[model samples]
Target chain A: MAKVNRSLTGTMGRSWLKDAQFTPLAFLAPTIVLLVAFAFIPMIWGLALAFTDYPILLSPKFIGLDNFRRLKDDPVFWASLRNTFSYIIGTVPPRIILGFVVALLLNQAIRGRNILRAMFYFPVVAPLVSVSLLWQWMFNTHFGVINGILRMLGRAPVPWLTSSKYALPAVMIMSVWKTVGWNMVIFLAGLQGISPSYYEAAEIDGANRWQCVRHITLPLLRPIILLALVISTINSSKVFEQVYIMTGGGPGYSTMTLVQQVYHSAFQSYEMGYASAISLVLFAIVMILSVIQFKYLGARTDE
Target chain B: MLRKFSVALSTMLALMLLISFAAAAAPAELRFLWWESPQRVESIQRLIDEYEKAHPDVSIKLESIPWDEYWQKLPILIAAGRAPDIMFMVSGNVQRYAEMNALLDLREPYVSQEVIDEMYEPHRAMVTYQGKISALPFTLTTVTPFYNKDHAAKAGIEPPMTPENAWTWEEFKLAAAKMKQAAGSPYGVGLGTRDFWLLPFIYQNGGAVLNEARTGSAINSPESEEALAFLQELVTEGIAASPVDQSVGDLFPAGLMPMSFGGHWDMARFETVITDFDYGVTFFPQRKTSGVGLGGDFLAVYSKTPYPKEAAEFVAWLTSAEANGQYIAENYYLSPRQGAKVTYPSRQEEMNLAQKQAELASVRLTADRAIPAWDKFLQVIHSEFQMVMIGDKKPADGLKAIESAINKTLQ
Candidate 1:
């Protein structure tokens, strides 16, 4: 028994130094180094920057909690923070629900399935800058196609991009339309992974289509759904381009997102330290949200 | 064989030293960088060619970056101690670069009293920082009201073509409403959505953006509130377009807007875009005074430039009356120099009014640049102003909010 234990320990301890194990790490070294250089180092640097007064053109001075203190009284900062959360809430659930529904429908062996799938996925492949620009034109109050359609329906044209009340909603609608396809593709992959035998078994047990979906499909797709939810939430929280291009965080601070604030502070204002502080707050919020999502959904997913 | 080898090596070494000396004797290479547009680039290149021709001992390498990317890259280059020998700066950024000690002083030997006297007082004030001339402004323009002739005729209103004939605040608003009603224009006037563009209104109302010492916002005063309230009324009544509704300056060219504020520089583009409508440039509408915000680019020498003397010489020459007048005339821009005689090929009538308006340009327009992070302050002002214009907040409330935000930056 002692010899067997010794053998197990020796093999395990020696395995990492062997060519087989060492080769994988050698291959991964470039990626690990790159990740550390680009991602982790900047993150740490950004955190450190939050504690200093760094004007981009000047040397950074240690300033303790001054930036954070300033942020507390900053109305724009508060408005942007509120907008970010609203954006996540407004975008993520709709994207996930719509994506899931579309995925379930497309999973059927219908005619033109491939063409339909490609059409839905087209938005995911289009460049975001152009997409945002196109949507900006489409959201124009008087001349836009959207407003034209509303007028044709005998409805008053909505001040989609101009009015503060509708600006955030307009941006969210564009974002959902742009990204729902991505989630659909993800859900489609997950749906295709589920075994058809489970449905057959449910059918043999005299289960109806709804029962089969409820008992079999949903339970199996639980982990994928949780994954999609978390990813969508994080992505929605970081929404910037659409708001930036479509509304420019205005008519008031209506469509301003946290990321736009970060860009504004850093590049526009050159207040790198304050920008870093905003970034840290954003990171912390995203981290907390992701942890809560995983904690709640991950448990059910595990079951 | 050793002796022969030694002699040959000595000969090669001497030749190498000669080549090194020849290289050291080459003309000083100075880098001049500026943001580019077609006419501006052509005019600048023309000046550079002339400068090079006159100063054979100095060579200049001209470089241009597109406007948006230029601001982003310039600061990084300056921070890295690789700034161009001479670079173009705007009046609003002069304070920033001066505060950073990135600009060379042009007061003493570089700029003469004759040259200083030739420049307009407001232009001189724009380049001055703490009693030192930090830059030499070349071309100057001011925001003026441009109107479509057909629309004005249709509305039966005469657009202000001179300072004396400029419309009063009430007349301007009433005329805008009239134009909207008669011409079927969506937005009768397009007030540009920018802090600088808004400054003309504030200054015309006898209001100052910042206090005497530039420590805090003075825009909370009754004068400024009244000015802003007028603007808010124009926007709320749909006499002027909101930035949200359409791209502000585009509507005029599209024939959707009857009147709009623009600089002399915009005339070139209008000459192309307004093919259908005959548009004429005029002075901004009057309040208490015909004060308009100045728009100009300055030539500044980098403090750390190795060829400071050459850079300063080029800057001085480029901004000289003869050189500057030719460049401005060619590009249809008003010269910043009071002594410079600029003549445009066409639109001489509009150019004359633009020149008159340029002289009336306000010093208070670029005063907020003295405050650090003025861009950020402008963002706050922009949003608050938008709220006021959209009737989401009162003018007084918006001004107070702007003051509070600006004061935070001051601290």
Candidate 2:
């Protein structure tokens, strides 16, 4: 009887090991294949391409550091970088602040609050290309409704997009307008997730609305704000489509973003290698910024 | 085991289905890519039907994309080694692609010597790259003066009929100012901040954007500076509305502006829109020389195309005088074929006006006089001209900057 029991136990143990081994592999196989094919392979190829002089039609020649060397002196690339930073610096804080403020207002007990939330989020769901074209008409220098309103109010018409001085800022304003709804939704989610008991406890302690927000709401919302910041930062850095459809990187490259520069170099100019180098630089910048934000905000969240 | 066997059987069936579908189609498919214009598409489709009747073996597939996405899409298709057999080619981009050997040399198969001679000299030259015919010109347009006859008459100036009779820069400015004064709260000329309108002036003043070899800048020359200064004077002296806060088309047709620089394409729309006022077309005003910029489309075959023989045959037939005239006439375009006649009774005046503009284009599109680095140079010109228009840079400074930028691009 003891010997039979021992054999059965050994068989059970074998079955457990066999089941454990194949289950994880079976589940992970698709994701692993996806990562290898789409992410890992392309990244490796892109990195390899950065060292070559590869124009799509010609045979790629290894020209070490030539593309990088060119980037140092390319005024357009530098200008694009500056414009990108300007877009980021100009776009991020306002998007976050405005988004949070709107989200806070919506958190109030008002009639038709849900409808108001839907109204704010409408632009987010509307197609980008359509909205951009609509904005183009709105921003039209003469016949545009905006200018017409401004004229009626007895103000001089602003060259919202055509002027180099205002082009980047104009694009930023549009960017903020298009995306604040999305960010507001996230902030609202964060705001709602906060326990009502904390506010109640604050009220019991004679805390005013401002003080309650300063002490309880902000600290608890830190992680959510950090998430919003990281997302907006990354997004603003890579701004392309709106600027592309709206300006085509013009009024003298005032609104040319880094991604536009990458696209032009790679496709239009057919300088794929040089474009890859620029792309790598952009990747490094994004990665560094993300890491810093993660460390700073991650530690704060932990505390 | 039975389930696995069933799965294998289904996969085999699917493969067989695909194979049969592929093998069943033996029709001659001629893929044509072009920019979006409903009228143009309808006309081209009619031509295609005619061709199909003539050659039952051929079936034409037309792909239309908007003008903005057309150029961007072509390169991607080329890089993917799946470009359309026949596609639209602009003069500015033809040479660049031809140099890369992306375009199929049409000189040998489709463009015979006799057929080539039958084409207008300017049209033939526009598509010739490195002594090989790279494309066939479909329509030709040149930037010319489009004037509101009422406004011009009010200014006490008759519209210039010939190149010699055209206004000088100074005279043109005075006429514009006089017109503006006559029409209260209206502008004289609509000065757009686009390179197309500005290039004719730049070239007419003997200021080449790039030097003869197309390797360096010539825009910093005294002539270019003079040209830009003249344009600036038009804006600053209130002879023309600053492009900053106006649409030239809206302003021009409303009889708010006397004259605007545009091409033949605008003629059709203008004729319909400007019923209240009479308008006429004339040559762009000359300075040191007569200069006009070439604007039009060309047809080319991709080098990677599998149906080169069929593609060449179709291109040859389409560019024949009869077919060319039919297509151009339907679309209200100026046919590149020498002596090709268009019969659009409703738009007879506009057609005649386009013919006149085409003659001016013939003079400008001559290879000997044409700027070889035209595309690259124009990018710089657009930027520099914008700066000057906006009063951000002095005209001379703008010219200098454009010259530097052009030189850099050429290098």
Candidate 3:
């Protein structure tokens, strides 16, 4: 009877362990299932579609590498690529710098500091489409607020959105304005996590505010900076809503971006295969940039 | 245990029988799909209600996707062989879906001669892909000039707001210049530099965006070049609104533009926004002849639908004189049905002008321009035209580039 009771208890213990192991998977099943359904399957399907002639209504035909090869001579695609890179180049650095500066400013115990921080972070929470349209009104030549001010200063009106010369610059300005706040918040978190002992030590060593930031704050904030940089770069690369709402990729395609091209090709042109190919390239570019960020500016204990 | 098992089995058997019986009793369902504006939804619901009341045994399901997602979602649905029974087709997209054999032919034994004849000549031509009608138009945009009467009075111009007294091309230019000089407005006229907007100028010059049979672009012809040059001249000389600097939205409603080449459909918005100034509509300015392009929402029955005849009957009823007329009056567009008169309770002049614009336009219109590759054509021309207007490309070079790009797209 004792041996029988012992055997029964052992079996119960083994069953309990099995249930414990399965509980985590049961909890994770929802997320894993969701990711598999929405993300994994779509990624594989898109990559598969890139090699075919899938024009939505028509049956997809396999024509391996033709879509990619066509991209070599495609001027619009090249132009959109150039514009996207230009957008990244134009907007990212300014955002990082402005965010760094603002984050540093907000970190200090200034008067109404919380209010000022909130004010700076407002644009981040605001919808991009609404702000883009607001910017459109401000950039209008004959009637915009900016041009109105320009005229008040006796300067000629600038054709901000309607000309290739100024449309991108205008978009960059809007992007910087819209994005800097989110970067600031991320950076503000990084700044708060930083120890004040380092600053005090630097102060004792006769370091000024600028020097303290240069030697201590910046070095400490490298990981956060890199994080912000990668996130912002990735976000800007996929810019379409703003471009669509503001310019519609017009004024001679000066403001066209890769995602916008993807949207147009997929929906308007119905060349889903080509759109998928362009998207794959965009995905590759983002992946490479992210890898580089992680490789070079990843977290280090010393820093 | 056996008692519980027996109870469950009986329940399962009962459920299956109940489901089968329910299926047998279910009415035939037809799904009607469309991209909706707020007003259009109400109108569609009313029409659906009317149709349902007429046929008690058949149920109509109305589904509306927002405009932005409709294009992407509809294609996926169609590609999966689960297309709506009836789908709303646009001018530029009709040829594409029709070519894919996704739409039923609304011709011969399916539609009567009287119903076909009731469709305006241009609208009739538009829905006929290859030789069979694939869709029936509901309401069409016939291009005409919408002018601010207060600005016209200030400019000391009579400003012919009638089809009989429609401005000639030279007269239109002079009117623009006069409006600028007299009112001190920045731009005399706002000509939307979009491809659809530029169609009137091309039509006015007897040039076309495509060759017949829809093989290649015919926009590089001498007439088209002349049209392009004239447009460039207007921009460079600061008569027409610059494509980049200001839009019709910025110029006209702001009391800065005297005349703009727009369509009757824009009247509703103008009525609301132009409170400071009074406006009137007129026929598009003539060159070789007065010209307008046909653009409209079309109703198409899906080729694979089980209720093809029923869908066709619903569409025919929806676009008929009684329905189309009432629909246009409510929705603010010109009816595509011949002799369909829509009376607006307010803004009757806008309705009257739309009718006149349709008359002037429908006589010499074809949907050949709204080919499968029309989007590509628009992209090419709009970019080149902007470049030309902005002094980046010479007019002839722009036309040549546009021609080359279009040919490539066609290939």
Candidate 4:
């Protein structure tokens, strides 16, 4: 009887192992294959490339720390860092606040409120390149519609893009215009999710609309706002196409971003290893900023 | 059931992968990259078809990028080790690529010395690097003065023809001023801050963007300063409209500006479009000397190309006098080959007149005289010149800034 029981147990265990081996793999095969082929393989290749002095035509030579060492003195890399930080700082707060305010305004019962919302959201849905080109024409110092209006008003036409002093700010203005609508849509969704009962309760407690928003809506929207802020921060940090299309990193590199610098270094300047080092530095900065934001602002979400 | 599904999916994926691999390895293909107008691209396709017919075993894949993205795209492709076998190049970038040894030398068995001599001296020199030919010269561009004939006639000033008869810088300024005064508009000459238009002024003033060694920026020299000051004077004195941030051709054709500086590449288009007014080409005015930036395209093969011999053969053939002359005549470019005549459309005389003006406007820094640092230094000079034109900085201060910037780049 004991031998029979042991034999049955052994058979059951072998069958269970076979089932376990195939089931999870069957469920996860597609994802595993995709990750290995797309993400893991490319990442390994890029990491290996970073350690080598490689011009595409020549054989790659292992030059371990040399690329990193050169990154220390690359002035363009540092300028790109500063420009990226400025862009993040300039764009994020205004975008978030404007998005929230516009959402709040549209939430009120007004005539053609839906139409207004659509108008506000139109820019976000529009193709970015088209928006950039349109803005470029609008900001043209001479024949552009923006200057045309300014001239009619007897105001001196501002050199919207040509001046180094105004190039970054002008780009930021376009960025804000193009992005505020999308954020507004997200905020609008978050606002709608907030139950009206909370506002009713606040009203019963003798609170004004401002008080209701501060005491109730603010707390409820914290998670959404934090998410928006993080997303916008990442988006603004990687800003490339608008600046490239509008300024081409011109007026003396005032508008050059880290990505543009990397592109130039790796391709135009033929310094791929150094570009990789710069990219690694950018990655580190993005990671650190993400960690800090999560620790401080993201914690409020759980509460 | 799960086992059966897993087995089928894996088998399907494996089969797909095998098919893709087979497709990838099916044929040896030559990738050719170029940038030209859509109409011109069509013309190129016709020639490519002929080439393919003669060499049935070889297949060519053409990738035509827009002009604006061509420079940016080529470098990226090169860095990625996916650059096309044959590609379009320009004088501005020839030095950059040649210095990096990214281009194949064409002076070997493919291109003959006789063929090289047949190319205009400047054109041949532009593609020559370190005593070796690096590319085939396809076209040559010289900065010629374009003026609205109606505006000139109305002002009672006939446009000058020869360099000697060409209006002096002062006379050019006065003529522009008179046009503005008569038109009751603050428009004289249209000056756009593109390097092509600005470099000629520096050349005419006997100012080199870089010193003779091409090691430091010479834009801060007295001659460069005078040139910058003269342009600023044009703006400040209302002899030319404030250099608008638009293409010079766009402004001129719109009848917003009377005189502009441009190249012959746009001549065909201008002739077709400017039916509202008569326009003519004249030699650009001189300061202390006459100079124009050499502008045009070059055809080059990549160093890593698998079929360098065949690629070189195609390049050589394309740049041959017969082929180049046809191309120029078709596309309105000035053929770089010596004595290659192009028959223009119904306006043949006008075309000849424009060609003569271009010859007269030809600057000292032809393809032969260009160095590797030419483009970078020219960019530095252009930025400084733009700053001066906009009254952001004095010409002297701007020149100093430009010199330092160029020196830093060279170092």
The DockQ leader among the candidates is 1
Ten-residue stretch with the least lDDT total in model 2 chain B = B362-371
**Candidate 2: regions farther than 4 A off:** A1-40, A140-155, B1-28, B153-157, B181-187, B241-258, B271-278, B362-378
* A215-302: candidate 4 lDDT, tens digit per residue: 8887898888888888899899889888878877666556888988777666555556666777777777777887888888888778
Which candidate comes out best when scored by lDDT? 1
Deviating ranges (above 4 Å) for candidate 1? A1-20, B1-23, B53-57, B324-327, B369-373
- The A-chain TM-scores of all the candidates are 0.93, 0.91, 0.91, 0.89
Question: What is the TM-score of each predicted model, taking all chains together?
Answer: 0.92, 0.87, 0.91, 0.84
A92-190: candidate 2 lDDT, tens digit per residue:
999999999999999999999999999989988998888877787688765678888999999988778777888888888888999999889999999
Error of 2 at B119 (Å): 3.4
| Tens digits of lDDT, candidate 2, B1-411 | 999999999999999999998755666787899895887888788888888998877788999988878877887777777688999877666767777788888876556787778767766766777887877777766675677777677768776666667778877787778877766534677766566567667778877666665567777888878888888777666677654443455777777677776666676677678878888776667777666656567788887787777787788888776787766655566777777777863557655755765566434424423333455345456666766866678988888777776676667
Candidate ranking under TM-score, highest first, comes to 1, 3, 2, 4
Question: Candidate 4 — what's its lDDT?
Answer: 0.76
The 10-residue segment with the lowest total lDDT in model 1 chain B = B364-373
lDDT of 3: 0.83
Better of 3 and 4 by TM-score: 3
Give TM-scores of the second chain, every candidate.
0.92, 0.86, 0.90, 0.87
Docking class of 3: medium
RMSD of each: 4.0, 7.2, 5.8, 8.4
Task: Please give, for residues A13-74, the per-residue lDDT of candidate 3 as tens digits.
Answer: 99988778787789999999999999999999999999999888988899999999988878
Query: What class would a CAPRI assessor give candidate 1's docking?
Result: medium
DockQ ranking, best first: 1, 3, 2, 4
